[model samples]
Target chain A: MRYSLFVGCTIPNRFPGVENSTRVILGPDHLGAELVEINEFTCCPALPTFYSTDRVTWLVTAARNLVLVQDKNADLVTMCNGCFSSLLKATEELENVNKCNFVNAALASVGKQYRGRLVRREGNRSIYEPVRVRHIIEALYTDFGREGIADRVRHPLSGLRIAVHNGCHFLRPTTRTSVDDPAKPVMLDTMVEAAGATSVDFPDKQACCGAGGGIRLQVPKLANAITKDKYECIHAAGTDAIVTGCPYCLYQFDHAQKDLKVHPIPVLHISQLLALAFGVDAEHLGFEWHFVAVRPFLKKVDAVGVV
Target chain B: MTPGGAPEAQKKRSTENGSSDAKSAEGGPLIVEDSVFTGAEHDPDFVKQIIRYGGKDVQTCLQCGNCTGVCPVSLKTPYKTRNLIKLCQYGYKRIFFTIPWICAGCHRCHEHCPADINPAEVFVAIRHIEVREKGVPRFIRDSTALILRHGFGAIPSDDIKRYREKEGMPPLPNTLPGYRKVLSELEALFRKTRFTELIGLETGEGAAGERKARERGGEASK
Candidate 1:
């Protein structure tokens, strides 16, 4: 389904290629971006809820976005695992009879209304949808007459043995919205394979990238311990690079790798790698969003070159 | 109705809740006693049940209040983990129902124990007794049903979610997503292991949306 790029605040602000690269690579392949605009969308109320206990207004404001998406009948997508969880959780919760009334009434004062609909967060996070669409929604619109995506791949990225790190929130989140086995999740690896790169099998493949919940903020020490194991797993995979779908995971892995005494492997968002492989310009793909600079590699050919 | 009402009540409750200058209130312990002679003393048979289930360890509790100091629920509510232990040690069964539901199962108490006793385990024992002997509160019973059915835990239904959101709730990620995956794998890896069954995760159909849920929790996918 053609979906809106419902990005959470982080993408447009901090790590932009999240959308820049997502659009650059996915655009040529036919994933059209329908941006969802809530007259005024606010934070999903994630941090405050952890310190104080409230869900009604959080769900109410969250539904404001949902109503906007439902107005267009497009699928909701977001790059933030947290926003994805909040929007989906808020939508599902607001749809319930007993629950909807209070949240809707709360929304009334804020001049927002939720009409029992779900909206995707912008820069839509990776949804492990059950049906695999080889060509994105944009591809359906833009690349209809062209050769399928496979034939157009200019660079196979064949020799790359990639390690896939599924961020904690992507799946196996404590509250919900995960699409794979939290313990042995395989969605990200599967996607990496679909993109024509070999997803290396590793012992800690299912471990988190240490960017989860409020762990990074609330307890950096604890976050470190979690990432420590994740780094070890990635190291064992002996891959050419690390590929993660979540922006936060990408950020955390990059940051954690910066101070490391060992392990200088590069970290790339799945889309950036895909864009580079598909013949998109490295400069345009927001390669600069990364804190840890990627190792320079000479491309054998341009991304669009069929040979 | 509105979620605000409870916070107002909680605020009023807090005036009473946090109002505790415990040293001035009771001097010895800010505790409620069941020794008012309700014609029921500790049931030996029930005490036997406690021992059979491992609550026999609570019998040695020194009443140091360390459990009270670090209780997961007590920090949130006016719950007294030490007092609950005393009640169990004194054979108070009526107060047993409300004592342990708030325990978060984090094992923090066990780690801090001077006696190597697990108050968390004792709390679990209380839950077990409630499950096996006395019936649990409907909400908790349903929550357990959903958890056991789905293999992960649950979140408040839209009712609570809306209330919480209106209250400007913090972002609390539900454990179900991670737990469900963890349980699904555990179910497969430990198909024959009783630990899976002991934890009440036997199947993964907990993902099934039940129309029966009223204030029922949300079922999530990864």
Candidate 2:
């Protein structure tokens, strides 16, 4: 159950609480999965950044990060969907011999090369074992199934109604992925229910949070407009809070509520929710950095009491 | 429907009405205007560049509105991916620079496209073309510079650092800011990839700052 923890940039920079909660929940005492933190690891070079402007740089940088993961000899587990998407796409691209060689040529300048953990060859085509990149939800859902999660919940959140935002990159470009049904995602919802909260279906459940692809940075008004629709839908559903696996979505939902006229709802990363359900206090989860106060939500959890 | 199916059908409907300004069965004006058939703005190489940059099967797009129907940005903005792809196939290179940047890159259109057009990937190709032809946007340039300098897309603020310290975690996670070797390696990779040049950072204010830092021998090593 050991894996390399790729927090990417957002979790550590904007929300260290996610990193803390993730480590606490998956640490030796909880899931007993050992997380290897490689100091040499850099950003996943998120797709919205270099992948859009410079494909070669994006592929080379991502290949370098994968080289570090391959050196660790463990599957890469990321808390950010953007990281998962970039690393997974890079792995797919690097499977081609020509692209791999081209990236290796660039890597040579930095005294590194991407071998891709070559496994075998088939008719002049080299089949390399791509590094398995998984999102935190996928790791949690697969490694510890719904029953495993339900069995461990010490503080059941019975009265809570959650809107699970799967985030676009987690289940999209659906042709290459099989984690869950992209259109009607149930992994996050089922996990939310496993933790004792009722998962509510919202109108904009599958819509993008409008934070990805530089929309939040470039045209924030449009981003806010898109997020506004999502907020209204979730607010209409009467959910106590919004839960998501992607930091970008969490950031957008948590921060965008300030401008919208809808009621402010607390946004939580899935790890933060699971951590609270697993009996970790709010103080340890780094809820202080959130744009919206989490105190009321904490009080609600307290009122629910232990099951 | 095939690639040319849309225009051919439009031409047939207009000829049946015996006028260029044809009325649809619904008694409204034609959706696509006659100006679209002029090919005055067409640049065939744009489509080839898009295909080269991993925008697969874009030419096979049936001009179906499925992409626009599923696009979240299209819902709010004037950025319809269906129209953008149509323009791309029609070889309107300049149009890509304006509208493609509005894409939020959700990839929903890619998921729902029956033609397997992958409009999201097409948008990325257009973004690359935009960056090369026109300079990177302010926020993108600033963020890319941060990655070049700190080996991360973002840097934690002083308040964020204090919170981390209060929480009994390292103020800085084990990323580039914490390791000079990793930062240097990333800088070398940046040079090798010509990322700075590609993003327009090599010449202009960005380069001057680096030059000045090197002259002072201050943060260049950083």
Candidate 3:
């Protein structure tokens, strides 16, 4: 299956490994999903900054990104939850004729248009459709079922316990994003298990990683405090490391431990874990870029020898 | 319902308090520590304005504590989703300037609110109103300026570029900032949206002028 890969801004810069791992996992020899890159894409414009400042501008900016993906004739697949939230939320808004027309007027200035993908007609009103936006984890869970994921694991990560952090943007605002259960999330755990690791349940399993909503960049003290809370719970669960689909959460879990001077728990993007299970070498996954070292995690997963 | 009914009720309650001290000395908004405003009048249109800005159910909020109980940020910060909504319902416009900025946008409150208030969305609506009234915070302005310049929020540092090269990936992903032509397209879009002006990045002459200033600074430093 072909899809447009949106790495957003953070993954390529803060966590290139997640993007690199995703590429390897979806390689032709592996899951065989073709990723079309739209290099002209910009930041998702992230909700906390753009939406807060000007909702119309945020919607127009996101619609521009969606237009690029639509031109590729492939479904949009985002690696970052922030990117997923921004794009998906804009897509929902653009369905209204007024919003679609308003966004199209702005796109017209840039020599583009947002002809929403799911267009239909009802009575007298023209119903434009929101584009199909999917987070990478959601795509992985749906496109490659658990059995299919299990079949590809060259080195099953048995004996390692991983805490799954399904960061808020991916699951919450349930009415809009129905990717998984918002309250009692099990999809991430199921995906973790598919890679042959035990997905440990922790208190506040669905809490924010404190890196979102400009919390980390703005009020860092509060952000670190929230990160400390998540770490406390993960520590209590006694998991070997944390796994998440969002680079922001992964960034928080990986870096905030060092910032808060708390007990450091290694963090990995879900795709990185899956890449390890698929027998890809650790060196290619960009583990060195991580603030908190993943050596202990590497050894626990038996991927150290390869590194 | 009387058009100014809420304000009339507020005024009557202020007189009923039996002490003129509750009113601000200069007749501005009065914010008693733990009580509803007895002197200041509620901006009767505030709820309608919020509802129009995607806080669709803010009016329907029953002030249940579910949104607060489920808010993870409230656990650490002084931010209470329920209290913020109450403040909005009471039409204390100035409170939006500070209180809503603390929201992490986790949306857990969106799911748990029995009133289906989606307090997180209400916070965004409040933020929108706040931005129009008082401008944005410094970090937000700096971050938006970065996006307008580089086409992304986070500025890529030298270390990140070196790491990307070592990993055999391109130093910069072929994105809006990586390609001049692509960045120009974003510039055109931003121009249409007044993105640069909204963020105050264009001091006098807009983005072109800012680029010239940066170039001058670069030469001076050299």
Candidate 4:
């Protein structure tokens, strides 16, 4: 289970906790997935804003990142929904003959080619391979089945209610990302349950976190309003905390909760929670870096006493 | 007609002379070309552009309002996905340009569209049109300039760096050595593709400030 980890801009620059926790949870002492960092990688360049503005630039930029992954000869796993969608969909689109040719031409000047799916011949035999891109959740779900994850939980998070926010890009535009049923997604919830926590069903579980599509930066009031509905639903569910696979959604939920002056609920990337269940210390997991404090929640978890 | 006292007599005279005057017989405004139908309000190329930009199924929208019903932002903002689709089909470029930005890109509309029109993609197509034909929005210009300059959209601040250090994490990753080469390649691609011009980067104030800041930061990092 080797993957070139695509820790897109948000996770590293905004929430190093996410990057730290993901690395720790997936390190040899825990889930043991081989995660490699490709230092030359740039931003996934974001999709809604950048991609919408210019398809060619979007395709070319995404292709450049894909070429880097191809150079490593490893599948790409991203923790950010935006990066996952951009890289995965770009890979799918670049597999098209015409789109690939056009993008490859653009890559030529940059000294790269998106030979997305290629066959090589050796000794009267041929080998075929296609690039694979997956979100960290999908990679986890596939690599370690539900029971496998459950077995690894050193501390079952009993009585810890969690509201799972399946951010849009993870399950959306289904044609590009078919990891789960877009309309009724349960992958994240299933993973949450596998971690020995209760995954509460909220009304806006599948709604946008008001941060996607550059709306947070563009029309922040609208973004905050949309996030307000999500918080209301999460509050209605009476969950202790929120869990999201996407860092942008984590930032939105974390930041918006403060801006709206609502009852503060801690937001965690799934990896952070998984790291907790795997018996990693809170300090190493980057809990202190969170805007909304996780100490109260951690105190409660400590009271639970590894049951 | 008694010193412009009767609109009927003035209308009659104007009709007799085949003159479409701006003022009525009462010395008020006349309603010329009011509520008149003009066949196919949009240019044919408008539909073609939307399709070309990946909204191939936009014309197939059934107007069922399913997209609008499911849109998260539509509830708070006036950004109804269905209305935007309708406007796009009708070739209402101005409305399409401004209204599509309100979409949060949640894709609920895309997921629920009975027609599978993928209204989100349609909105992206509309945004593409807006950026190319009009100009990129300020937020987009600022953000894009950041990526263009720093090789990352959000540069980790000193405070963030200090926090990462406290956490025992490695300093946040900066642009790898020879990042300038990669940045230039990207810029050239942007230039050759005319994305620079389309987003008004050639003369955009946002781009200029971002470039200056990037230069200072680049030197400082060195």
lDDT of 4 at B205: 73
**i-RMSD per candidate, Å:** 17.8, 4.0, 4.6, 5.4
> What does candidate 1's lDDT look like per residue over A158-235, in tens digits?
656788876544553323234555567555565555556788887756555554544444334444555667788778
Once superposed on the true structure, which residue ranges of model 3 sit more than 4 Å away at CA?
A118-129, A173-175, A303-307, B1-42, B162-178, B204-222
Model 4 chain A TM-score equals: 0.95
Best-fitting candidate, scored by DockQ: 2
**Candidate 4 clashes between residue pairs 3 or more apart in a chain or in different chains:** none
Docking class of 4: acceptable
lDDT at residue A16 of model 1 (Cα atoms)? 55
For all predicted structures, in order, the TM-scores are 0.52, 0.87, 0.86, 0.87
Q: Is the docking of candidate 2 incorrect, acceptable, medium or high quality?
A: acceptable
In the range B1-222, model 3's lDDT, one tens digit per residue, is 222333345445656662654444234445533334542434657788888777765668888788888776777755567767876776766545534366888887877778877887787887777766777666666556556666776555565566667766544544334577667777787778887777667664344445654454344224
Report lDDT (Cα) of residue A54, candidate 2. Answer: 87
In candidate 3, what are the lDDT values of residues A255-306, reduced to their tens digit? 7888888778899999999999998989889897789999889887775334
lDDT of 1 at A240: 71
**Location of the lowest summed lDDT over 10 successive residues in candidate 3 chain B:** B1-10
Candidate 3 Cα deviation (angstroms), residue B70: 0.5
At residue B64, candidate 3 shows an lDDT of 79
Ranking by lDDT: 2, 3, 4, 1
State, as a TM-score between 0 and 1, how close model 3 is to the true structure.
0.86
Q: Over the stretch B1-222, how does candidate 4's per-residue lDDT look in tens digits? A: 121222334345445543343222223222222211122123446778888887865678898998878888767654456766765665545434434366666677766778878877777887877777776677677667877876777777565676667766644445456667878878877776777777776785766756765764555334
After superposing all C-alphas onto the true structure, candidate 3 shows an RMSD in angstroms of 6.5
Q: Write the per-residue lDDT of candidate 2 for residues B1-222, one digit (tens) a residue.
A: 122444555445445553433221223332343423223334668889888777875779998889899898778755567877877776666544434356777778877788988898888887877887776766566667777666777666666667667766644644335578788788888888888777667778676654443343233122
